[model samples]
Target: MKLGILFSGQGAQKAGMGADLYAALPAYRETIDQASAILGYDLQAVANDEAKITQTAYAQPAILAMSNAIINALGDVLPTPVAGLGLSLGEYSALTASGVMDFNQAVAIIKDRGIYMQTVGEANPGKMVAVMGDDQALIESVLAALQAAGKRVYPANYNTFAQLVIGGVAADVDAAVEALTDAGIQRMVELPVSGAFHTPLLKDAALQLTTRLAGETFKATQYPVYSNTTGSVFTADTLFETLTKQIISPTYFAQALQKMLDDGVDTLIEVGPSDTLIKFAKKIAPKDVKRYAITDVDSFNAVRDLLLAEGKEA
Candidate 1:
């Protein structure tokens, strides 16, 4: 089976995300241990602490550590993946798994990236709203109208055909929602996020990340790693630059999924605490295939056993 691996991004993290993974797999425990050492904090402590788990500085590394642990535990049960992609911070997890960035270095860089974004978020204090029940053109029209009106809003995530998320100053986001509602849109909802992620509002954060990214090395990927920024494969030479751009650019998630499907990726395994990526991919492609989310010990074991049995049969 052609496989694609996915790592969860922010907004899906929660306390106790990795407890079952740690308890069921020794390798996963050690992976978290090593990652915690590199991060200078106990990942379990961070994962079990509700408040701390939500903070970007801790959340990014914790999710990375858990996702990597899950990947490590997959071992031979996971055949070489056709492609790997992650949403936002999950990109680092994908890169680490792809061998483009050394695991320890990835942990450090992701932690820093989170801290910088968090700093920028606190200073700017923006809001993100999910606008549904419309096409991208309509979403763009609304944002364009806002921009023309001198509102600070921008498109953040193109999650699906009908779902587009926009972000900016809190007041601007609210105003846009009000305008869209007045325009007869039925499904506009605000997201409870801390920052205007994936928008130019994060340009300052992206610049800080650029300086930090300069000091790191991104090696060639072991597999095709679709980029969220361009919704296409990213080369090693362009990885750092594109990752920097992803901070202030819209995350083309739907396009990236389409890229994987066009590349013949039929099976997708979401490795993280939430099934967000798996659900999103299936919603976009809506094709019948082997798709699953391994979020805990039971889910992990089920996937491992199922795939290992299939391998033997093949």
Candidate 2:
């Protein structure tokens, strides 16, 4: 039975995330404790408390901690061998799972990344908005119109036929949404993000991350790991560079899902706080594929039962 794991990015985080895992699994608590020491912050509070969990500085580390904790828990209960992929910041979780980065290093990097992104967001003053029921051509037309008007905006995520995200200066995003609405292109909703991520506006953050990435060491993965930058398998030599570019590059989650389907991934398990990735994958993937989101004890048990049934059938 071939299984693929997907990790959710930023925006999927919520208060009380991973508290169950921390309470039910000693390993999860230990992992969070070690991450807290490395980050010099209270990871448990960030995960359990609403105020702290919403801050970009705290949320990034909290999400990474929870995703890694889930992977650790799965290691004890599920098969060790499986393919992995992550969206945006979730890519760090995928790297750690693939053995390219250790848990401590991954946590530290994401903490720094969150700080850098927050800094850039403040300096540039940008925002992200989600556009539903639109095609790429319509999005491109809106972007072109914004550019013509001396406003910088671009597509950040191609989530699905029903969902896409645009990022740029707040005023420009608002203008583009108005134009799209007038044209009856799509429904645009403002996202609760700090800045224009995965766009040229984040070049400063990307440059800083490049330097940090050069100093780190990455190991080859025992299992295949898909990359968000290219929606392709990552090799050891290109892993760090690809990860660096991903900071300023739009995530190809839709393409990655298609690639997993082509690779015969019969089952997809999303390991994180939300079911967003699994839900998106189900909408985009072939109809025969099975999907599951293991966010809590009940969901994990259900996935375990399904895997057992598949094994028995095989």
Task: Note the residue pairs that clash in candidate 1.
Answer: none
lDDT of candidate 2? 0.83
Query: How far does residue 246 in candidate 2 sit from its true spot (Å)?
Result: 1.3
TM-score of each: 0.98, 0.94
Cα lDDT of model 2 by residue, 11-107, tens digit: 8889998877788877778888989999987788778888778777788888888888877766545665467888998888888887889999999
Best by lDDT: 1
Off by over 4 Å in 1: none
Model 1, 141-237: lDDT tens digits are: 8879999989999989988777889999999988888888887788878887889998888889999999998877678889988898988888977
Model 1 scores a C-alpha lDDT of 0.87
lDDT of each: 0.87, 0.83
lDDT of 2 at 149: 77
Residue 212, candidate 1: how far off, in angstroms?
0.5
